[model samples]
Target chain A: MAKKRIVTTTLNGNQTEFLCEPRQTLLEVLRDNMDLTGTKEGCSNGNCGACTVILNGRPVDSCLVLAVEAEGATVRTIEGVATAAGLDPIQKAFLEGAALQCGICTPGFIMQSEWFLSQNPKPTEDEIRFNLAGNLCRCTGYDKIVRAVQDAATTWQDHYMKNCHEKGCH
Target chain B: MRDFEYEAPTTLAAAIELVAKHNGSARCLAGGTDLIDQVRVGRLTPDVLIDVKKIAELNVLEHGATGLRLGAAVPCYQVYGHCGIVSDYAALADSCRIIGGVQIQSRASVGGNLCNSGPAADSTPSLIVLGAVAVIAGPKGRREVAVEDFCTGPGKNVLQPSELLVELKFPARAANSGSHYRRFIPRNEMDIAVVGVGASVVLNDAKDKFVSARIALGAVAPTPLFAKAVGDALAGQPINDETIAKAATAARAIAVPIDDMRGTKEFRLHITGVLTERVLKAAVARARGEHVDCRIGH
Candidate 1:
């Protein structure tokens, strides 16, 4: 028997610590040990983005990350996206656009979309499609999802630009 | 998945020492995009995983006057979008852009892709066509091997168990030289290549004759094989329909593909011909200092 590895990560704005087997995935650690189940697992091979999470501000499939590999890193799961009073803008737009059906893939999609919007607040339709290529939703045929992303982009741009203007970048 | 010990060493020397300490019981963990999945599937069972992501030196892309030196731990996304090396080596950039999805790209390191040594690896042909050299660090010390001779078979590489890929270096393209890469896949994204081709060409004045050439083919052999015969055919010839046809035929003759789930031997052979023609044309256009559009319709 091999020794269990101790991992500490700042998960969802909280300092979280857990012990995992060497083979334990970050997705498993989040769901089983940490009790943060918002991150789901699908197709454990990384084909499906159901286990997506923001690792150090980049969206990566949780299933593809070893729990031990994430030591001393910061992780943002779906549960961390919303504020105390409201959902994130992308999540709000997703709800407004009715972009989800069964909702199994929504968490991952939301996380990925949030990262994409951060990089490009005013993404064109083509840019949105390209950025979202890794994330898929079996439901909604992606039409409504694209619409939601576009809506989020507009909101994000207006808010970000206004904030930037207020900061006196000019 | 079986249990194992894990260690994340902050320094390159520490990472190498950890792997050596564990001997054959350890594996170097890169992006974990491929290593983790393999571990969960029981295809690999290293008793210890030496995480090398914290080694900053292994994650750099250094550019010099002659060529580029890419750290092994640099992610595909970094190579695709961030590295200046890609701007000059368009074929490598294009290949990185098509590897898996954004999430995979974020975690999949260029070194892991090369060290995985899969015949279908997207970066293999790209590096091969550009004449890249892999720098490896092991208990014995450091050594270098050409990318063209790095892989021995499926999932096999020349690296010893104690060795870790440290860096990848390739000469920058000379003036008037252009490189192009293209692959045929069943789907638009998140799929492996059924047939991949990368070609680099140096065009003389007016793009009349090829001063130098390199063509590397992937997914049709045990290793990513350079199309030396095709390169020979195009080396001194003018960019013309006749030359392209002959080069394509030459490339087709080198492949002996197998029947697999992604594609059949017959289809793979056919694609080798088609991709050869496409890449050569695009490479020629690039060699002439013109932007060659290689984007695919979804």
Candidate 2:
């Protein structure tokens, strides 16, 4: 049997350690070992963004990342999005806007949208659609999903303004 | 996917030694966007996975007076992220932005795209037209291969076992030069190219006449083609639709596509001319002024 390799990563704001074989994907590690099942597995290939996670500030499909490659990296899965008190602004927007149906792809969409919003806080509708093209929603035909992202962008902007009293450049 | 020994060596020499020990059974993992899926689908079975991202030589991203030195492990996001490269090598950025999405670009590297050597790979045509070269290192030492000559077939390249692609080197941008890449796809995003075209052009100081040009076509052939004659035909010709059409005809003539689910041979043949004309026009516009044509891909 191949020996399992111990990998360490700052997962969801916590120092995480897990053992995985070379054959296992980060998606598998997140779900099977860490019990962070929010990052769902869709195509198991890179096509589906259901396994999306923010790794080292970049959104990536977890299924495409080898488990051992997470060593010393900072990873933010869907599990890390919501705070102790309540859901993140994007999550709240997703719920309020009814951006999900079937629910399998919601986590991935939220994670990807959060990262995109961080990059371009005042994104236009075309920009949102262009940036979020990797994330697919089979149920909503993407109108509601785009609306939800727009909703989050506006709310997140307001939330930011209320806190800092000015627009923060990303 | 079969279990394999994973090795991440921090230095070039150490990585070379580890891969050399595994002989031909070891595969280098740069970005794993294509590779991990290849393994998961049982298309490939290897005994070792050499994670090359840790090696400094494969992560060097330097743009200097001479040219751009893009490390093999530098992801696509980093390539497009560099403002200078984006302006100087607009075609490279054009293709990189559309290769996958942000998620795939964040993890996939341009060097890995070259190494993957798929016929439809988005970056190859741009690499060829931009005159990029692969800097490879192996136990036998180092050698450079032009990007146009790198691939021999679909899913194949000139790289031998244990040979590592260190970086892709591009010569400094020539004066009055501009480049652009665009592909015909059925969908707006998340699709492989049907007939991709990359074009780099140099125009007269007035930007009304062609000084010289380079064109490359993808997905319409077994390998990405450096359409030298197509570019040659447009040299000295006035930068007009009629002159560009001659180059497009030449490109379409050389395209030998196969019928597949993505596109029929005739469809690819027709698109070969269309994309060539479109990309050439965009490239000419950029050569006149360092502007990126966002309209090309859409």
lDDT of each: 0.86, 0.88
For B1-298, candidate 1 gives per-residue lDDT tens digits of 7787778889988988988887778888889888887887889988888888788878878776788888888888878775566567889888888888899988898799999999999998989989899999988899999999999999999988788899899996787888888999877777889999999988887679898889999999998888887797787787898989888888999997889999999999999999999898888887776777665661
Docking class of 1: medium
Off by over 4 Å in 2: A160-169, B290-292, B295-298
Residue B160 shift from truth in candidate 1, angstroms: 1.9
lDDT of 2 by residue, B163-182 (tens): 88889999998889999989
Model 2 CA RMSD to the hidden true structure, in angstroms: 1.9
Best by lDDT: 2
**Top DockQ model:** 2
